[model samples]
Target chain A: MAFPDRFDGLPAAPRCEGVYKVTGDTRGNNVAIDVLGVTKVFGAADSGFRALDKVSASIRQNEFFTLLGPSGCGKTTLLRLIAGFEFPTEGRILLDGEDIAALPPFRRPVNTVFQSYALFPHLTVAKNISFGLEMLGWPATKIASTVERMLALVKMEPMADRLTDQISGGQQQRVALARALAPNPRVLLLDEPLSALDFKLRKEMQIELKRLQGETGITFVFVTHDQEEALTMSDRIAVMSAGRILQVGSPREIYDRPTERFVADFIGETNFLEGEAKVAGDRLLEVRLDAGATVKATAPDAALHAGRTTVAVRPEHADLVPGDGPADLTGVLKNIVYFGTDTHFHMTLDNGVPFIVRQQNTPGEGSGFSIGEQVGVRLHADAAQALKD
Target chain B: MQPHEVEQAAIRRGTMRRWLLSAPALVIIFLASFGPLFVMLAFSVLEKGDYGGVKPWTFSFDGWANVFFQHDIFTGELGFADAHLSIFWRSVRLSIITTALTLVLGFPTAYFIATRPRKTREIWVFLVTIPFWTNLLIRTFAMQEVIRNEGVINTVAMRLGMISEPIQIMYTDWAVLFGMTYVYLPLMVLPLYASMEKLDFRLVEAAYDLYANRFKVLRRIILPLTKPGIIAGSILVFIPSLGAYVTPRVLGGGKNMMLGNLIGLQFGKGNNWPLGAAISITLMVVVMVALLVYVRATARAGGDDRGR
Candidate 1:
């Protein structure tokens, strides 16, 4: 696990046996959490639910790391393991290079902002914020000052005397965050903390969370099903599916070049076209579609190229052309959808497959095509990505 | 004919229908409660008969006066009624001890039943209530057999060579306490289990996550949250133990008489029906006062009860 010095501070690249490869710097590395082949199974051994199947991940210090997936995808299970709520069934979790697997949740220097906020109903907001500090046996003066500081940090100074159940959902969310941060844990785990808020409030809290992370500089491992929230907040994202980590990369890397099938379909809207691919050049792929069109696509991993595979393309990667010249595929325009900032032109190809082309709206200019009209979509040179499925 | 008048007439008809539907229950409650209360009050102010019954239409204050003081046979002076006072004191003291003991024993039992898996919880609660299927007198006599001389405990101890003589436990206050606590235990556990069942266990996990150990979680979270159940169970056990006649009479063996047995003594052999009725009224007053103080302290402990 030699982390290269160049990638040390910027991205904190994860280097594992099957995930990444790095060189040069081997010492003086700061790894906040290294989950080594963690497996979690609920109930009996013979007949049990395998929530996580030997999932491995490396979260670095002060990184805004996200585990993004749909529901029941082991993201929350992984977060709970890190927060010491659930112990690994067969592996070790190293926090700051120390094995914290044997420590209970109270002994571990970690805190969680649960999705339900789980605040003490009998205590006021200030007492709730200072609960962790009180449990740690800090002096009354120190606890009082810290409670005041947390109240001001969450912008809930006036709500100090109000009970937790008496506050609004958004206010309770702020108090939960402040309470978890009061203890100043080495790592903070958040399990879908923003999923309960409305769209507008969720957006505001997303930015607020990023700001807080930047200010505190604690390693934050956030779990969410919302891909847009993950992309908007994370420094690096790990896309998971079905008790395993599907892919781990930057959001742009995950979106533009998903290495696997489920990752391609899960991250965002992807168009899949079956084709026979051949190695064109160095890191270049020549894919011949089933519809008699030969297009040059970029290989995500050149070493893993195969002959018969599917090429995934995003809707925004292609533009609709009137004639067939300089077009990758020609089809009939089936439908047109207009959004506020973009429009989607639904085209049925000559092979009878549904293909969508998205184009930005330039103020009063339409897509310049009507329904049932013949159209062709031209792909950018880097749009089509070769999947190794 | 008008819409407003028709609507008002319909509203009036609905109110009449509601009252009609509840009339039977209200009438039964009044007849069952106030009817006996009036008879008891009337008998308490009447003159005592020669044998057992009270004389009609002849009012006397001797029954009420005898409650606190007794006239001396030689000096014609009123003195403190030490016998009646001691009996009342013993009843109150035993009831409080019984309530405290049941709470200490029943809390852990209720918590255990509440924390069991949902399917098994019903079985545990059903077991707790199984004692109610039999008669209270039978249960008290069964308990007497366990604590009496030459009974189960003494016989087992002697057989095991652990004692040379039988322990004199049956005709003591300990016997009465044990019997009352045994009979009234289910009353405490049931309400406590009901409250513990509704507890949000995530809060307990949250406390543990925040560095609070097991004792702190019980004291700060579980105890306060289930105060309503604790108060309800205490009152349930305390009221019954206060007026409990069968257990104390069967186990106390006429020497350790409680308020219930003392009041019964007036009616059965004392030949003073007025004094018995007066003592019965006094016992009811003590129960009411105990309930008031318990409720007031519990209400203060839980401000406004909205959280529960």
Candidate 2:
């Protein structure tokens, strides 16, 4: 399926800078969380190492912002810091303009759905859903109605009386969501909420979570290591590595126009070609690859210097045709993998530079490219992105 | 080929291996433990000779009759009535006191130790269990020295002029309770620690998140979760305290003799094996009945909590 029309105006070719800010309709003027220069260290003073180093990001109210990174990238730690489970060794966190640095987890105006789903095993689904409401000292009548509403919202009303262990994992996840949402906190933090579910269930919950976010209008700060999940669910993703954010933008911007080599490799599969750049025109540039070949690409920013650099070209951008054409590289097909909807051909260039080309699986007989067959890998030079050294 | 045949073969193999491995220890346990109990039962019902040894196979209730009906020859104290009523009640009272004290003190200490960080918790648990490694008699003697006149406490009190005479702190009921609690404190703490360590702190956190204060958390979440440990610790402390002879014998002087001492007297110096056996049998029956009742009550309570 194609992307929704709402995302059509998004830059088709990755733009380098000035991505749109995500401010949900419900929270026009509110800044839900303003985390500044947050740093966290683990272990004791003599041996402790930094886990988050001067990390800073602002999540708008009612926006579903995701902290995306690979494992050990401090994304979860940053989320935990925002949730008040861990205090930052340095820096400040402001919720609605109040410093919540010294606040305990229970006192913070946020609730977390832990990655483990940490439901009280002894409590029933109804009791689990109503826990936060009871904590807020709501009347029994109000709590009952609220729990019933949340149960319906998460489509778990039928299993309300079942023990957490009695229900399926998906049902328990909904109960956890209900429990966290029942408090009606200003921000709801999820730590890899869907990582525990099967692929289909994860996809189903992704839609449910997005719909719930729209309905409730509560700001959500989701942490995930899955790049696809981050792309699918986040309004804006903060791509992080080695305790620092490399780039923060909408999913399209992060994917299409990554700011660094780490962001490019971390977000999706890309073929890196080391080259030198020279600005050719207002929006065009010439890159000389290390293999003594020159190619044309879009110059996204002035940071593209006239020195050795790397060019990141996504696999889908490279087209495999019948013969050599403009801005083309000749190669032999080493491997072809048919993945039901698309075919990927691993091609090695004449200079021994390896690259992949992916073609959509259309109806009728598609291109029958065989292994060890000679082919020309064509590239739309405009689709290639020039990166800073 | 058939399911029943396969099942039978597996069962036969399992039984053969189990018997081969356990036969020696099982025989030794039966001979060493149950043999004496059977002999005691038989001797309790047999007739006593004029010289006071058991008359083999001459079964009679004369020994039991003498125990229940006969008065003391020396002090005219009713042998059965006074010993059974006073000594039994004294032992029960002392055991109840020790068990309650152990529960009160051990619960907090166990909770603290269970909640410590991993490395520090290991050290604390080790310290709590260290006292149990010492000899029980040696521990009792150490307590004796601490509470005795001219011992460390009295020496200090005398030197400070807190009292003109060395306080009569030793050989009292308080001293007996103190010694019992000291010796059995580790037993109570260890079991309670085991249960409390398994307690998910998240439950307590959940309670607090549900607006439960610290005291409410203790009463509702902690107390109910650690009930098994409390029950087990109480039984451990109470059963041992009821049958304790040495601690009271040394610390209670001669004034506060418990049932164990009386049972010992009847069998040893008193030369009445049937009465001693009957008393011992009665004490065992009472303890067993108490244990059964406690277990039944706790099981019912646990069921009710789950129902809620």
Candidate 3:
């Protein structure tokens, strides 16, 4: 496209003079945003609601990072702090190598797509996109050209002259993203930006957001309560709860090797079995379940201290053995539920502890277990991991 | 009847019921507003009476002409009465000035109230409307007590060793302007507050995050969005101030007179009821012209907003 040539060899995003400086990154400033022990307390210093408690994380450049948590878990508060909308009560936020904790929102090279997609009702879609460049005193020609490029970027060229309120909710979301990205902020904060859409559209936009992040090369800090969204779109996910980050890792690592019980329970569906762990060997632990079953499990790297252990087994990892077979644990079949692609066997262990085993509905298997019958269940090796309580 | 014809008859019935429901309001507006206005127009075209009433059925152009011209007693020739023009000018100038001043004071107050926490916002709005609970005359008089010489301000300042003599603030344009602005302030604030209250402040935050400072945010995002409130509040403050009689009379001390006070003089001491009615209609015409200007301004703004 002719668009790339117009920016005059600069790059995907613009570098407005005072908003961001192009000083080469040194002193381990490869991280786009380095948050150091930031604390945010609202209302009163002595007895305020602590939204974020000494949270520290590093968001790498050009990575789609997500803060995943339930409601009121301080994910949005951390995003606001990085955007400079709210100041941290302690510590500092560094964008590149410089401290930006004292700067107001306008002085930082950051933008946000608010949860409501707060578009300007008074301006046309085109003018809304041009507002940032205009505020930076870009010449009229440059603003017009850049606005055109942004219109084409979001595929909203036909709706350029329409007022923001004249469009659908999804269209407004796109316009908001285009407007925020027009000025070429180094980082873009999304506060549950896709939470308002329907399920189908939310899925579509999730893919679109990832594509946009890849194309723009701007670090994306997405906040969401949907674990599936974080797992599907994020390069790294930070699990937060009660004003503190519980864990941070890739989606596979978070799903496979969750260190905390909360992380394991929050990221995906799992059957948590309470157990006591004794060191069986290096990288292994023998967990004696409260249900009077002893199962061998892998020891997570971080949760190896002397403490109680909880084994999290994904529902799909176990299979139902009908009357008797070579199985490690035994239970009585209570009920069975059928999903489209899979069937779940709900049963109770010998001591009344709930157990669920999910199996794909393979063709012509002809295996059935009646309720009120004792059954044997076998867990696949390496399916269990010890989590810290 | 045919099936489609029956449906059409039902639609007609619904429309007729709506018009019937609205008829009482239309009748009240016509009788209360236009009825007196037609009488004034008729009286403005008639001749002045000798005994302080209109000479009914007497056709004359003198009543309308006397609004701009009067007979010179010595020359017996008609000429411009500059006093009427000055009174008209004072009324227009002060109304415009009062609207500007109220807007200057009310915008920040409304924004502050709007940006406050939702629970405390109600309390601040309640405080703003506290002045409306009292009578306008009482409030004007209360203001008179504060700014007048030998009043609260002069007494307090003198006792505090701030000045030796009282400042003459009572009988000037400043007193009238001050009184009018103070009385009309709530009108501006309420509409501005209502609009500011509905404003999505996340749009404001978005503006700031997109590289707009406080000034740019106000200019680009805040002001244009709240323009309807500005227009409504300006009209509310400006119209009442143009015809103000009580505030000017109580605080302006007889020398400074607005159009309403001048119209009162023509009916009482001047004994020219025709001229009084003539000037009243002229005042209405001025109001219409001012409203036309406001409508033109808003239409232009609305057109620009459409991005044609």
Best by lDDT: 3
Q: If both were scored by DockQ, which would come out higher, candidate 2 or candidate 3?
A: 3
lDDT tens digits, residues A152-228, model 2? 89999888878788999888888888888876767889989999999999999999999888777778899999999
Indicate whether candidate 1 or candidate 3 has the larger TM-score.
3
The order of the candidates by lDDT, greatest first, is 3, 1, 2
Off by over 4 Å in 3: A1-29, A290-293, A364-367, B159-162, B305-307
lDDT of each: 0.85, 0.80, 0.87
Which residue pairs does candidate 3 place in steric collision? none
Report residue A171 deviation for candidate 1 (angstroms): 1.4
Tens-place lDDT digits, model 1, residues A213-322: 76666778999999899888887889999899988877888889888778888877888888888888876788899866777777767324758978888999988999
Tell me the TM-score for chain B of model 1: 0.94
RMSD of 1: 5.5
Per-residue alpha-carbon lDDT of candidate 2 for residues B30-139, written as tens digits (9 for 90 to 100): 99989988877777788766555677878887556654466778987755665467778889999999999999999999999999997899999899989878888888
Error of 1 at A91 (Å): 0.4
Task: Compose the digit string of candidate 3's lDDT tens values, residues A28-118.
Answer: 5457888899999998987999999999988777778899999999999999999998999998898875799989999887889999988
Off by over 4 Å in 1: A1-28, A280-284, A295-303, B1-23, B72-76, B303-308
DockQ of each: 0.41, 0.25, 0.77
Candidate 2 scores an iRMS of 3.3
Model 3 misses residue A182 by how many Å? 1.1
